[model samples]
Target: MTHAPTPAAMATRKPARTAPAWDRHTWEEALLAATLPHHGARLLGWGLAHLAPTSGQFRAGTSRDAGYLGQALRLSAKQLHMGFSQLERAGLLARAGAAATDGPRHVLAQAFTLTLPSATAAARTESDG
Candidate 1:
């Protein structure tokens, strides 16, 4: 006989996430909407989508350490570390200031800004001017 589900199990279960449907957008818009080629690009995209502020040049958030984020992203901490580095190298992600120091092991979250590729190019051009 099957037993009823336990409270612990019920509490640990997560609902399936639904993918967003696109409207009447252009092919280029759809292409740009896909995750970038960089390793951590998807993570940055996730931040931009979930953290609000999709318009404009930059999206900012305080990201928790890799282990915690990995759990939510279905990635390993090592993978998260690599992704973070890749995004930083591609100029897509960066520390907003310093790491937050108000949580466990003095490691809670990292303040970061995710920059759009067009904005990055514009910044480079302006600096060269």
Candidate 2:
């Protein structure tokens, strides 16, 4: 005998929530774009570099706590968060751990590493001045 379809199984899955819906962009996309314009990738690299030192010699699975302008990148708070999201996407960075904050726990505490780029290193020196 054929079994009848259950209401629970009949329910359709809902699409994930995106930004305000002014554009077809996801929140991650918007974060990356808004934060890093000409130097989206560049900013991300710098942030990664700084994370290592701040974490006190790189502990595996320990999330690096970096704000918007990690190291010498020179980015705004919003930009910093956006660049981080971008780095995570490009596979240049990854989440290692988590931490608690007074307000709320941001993903910053996770241990992360920066995949150095040739151009990025060069830009770092130039922007350092």
Candidate 3:
């Protein structure tokens, strides 16, 4: 016969699991510092924070939707747009969207992809030199 766990034993159980914190690579931080505006940097940070711990991709409902991201980051729509534009111009972000086909009213809906530089180039340079 099996016995039930005691209250003391249950109390000693491990705590609930949580997602690990996101850490920026040194190259990524340097790129952001050199190219992006302050607001753009903040937006990038928020995006990184919302990304999946293992995949480093933004979660659904947060991908490519500026309005949703703006609300989550507590920034205004205009600020979000500006930040997006800056990030895009810096070669750090890629966005794709289709024009609204229904009505004359245009809807801004797009998806973002973060581009990270690979370390292979640096390694190759070191080997050559």
What are the RMSD figures for all models against the true structure?
15.8, 13.8, 10.2
TM, every model: 0.41, 0.38, 0.45
**What's the residue-level lDDT of 94 in candidate 1?**
54
Which has the better TM-score: candidate 1, or candidate 3?
Answer: 3
Comparing 1 and 3 by lDDT, which wins? 3
Worst window of 10 by summed lDDT in candidate 2: 21-30
lDDT for each residue of candidate 1 in 3-41, tens digit (9 for 90 to 100): 999999999999889844422233224224444445344
Tens digits of per-residue lDDT for model 3, 1-129: 999999999999998999644344643573544434455555645564354344444433454455555566676666665555554455454555532333311113434455443454334323433
lDDT of 2 by residue, 1-129 (tens): 999778777686566886332221232243343323337554555444544453223454344444433444655555556655555454445555432232212445445544322445335434542
lDDT value, candidate 3, whole model: 0.49
Q: Give the clash total for candidate 2.
A: 5
Error of 3 at 116 (Å): 3.0
* Candidate 2 vs 3: which has more lDDT: 3
Model 2 clash pairs?
62-111, 63-109, 63-110, 63-111, 64-110
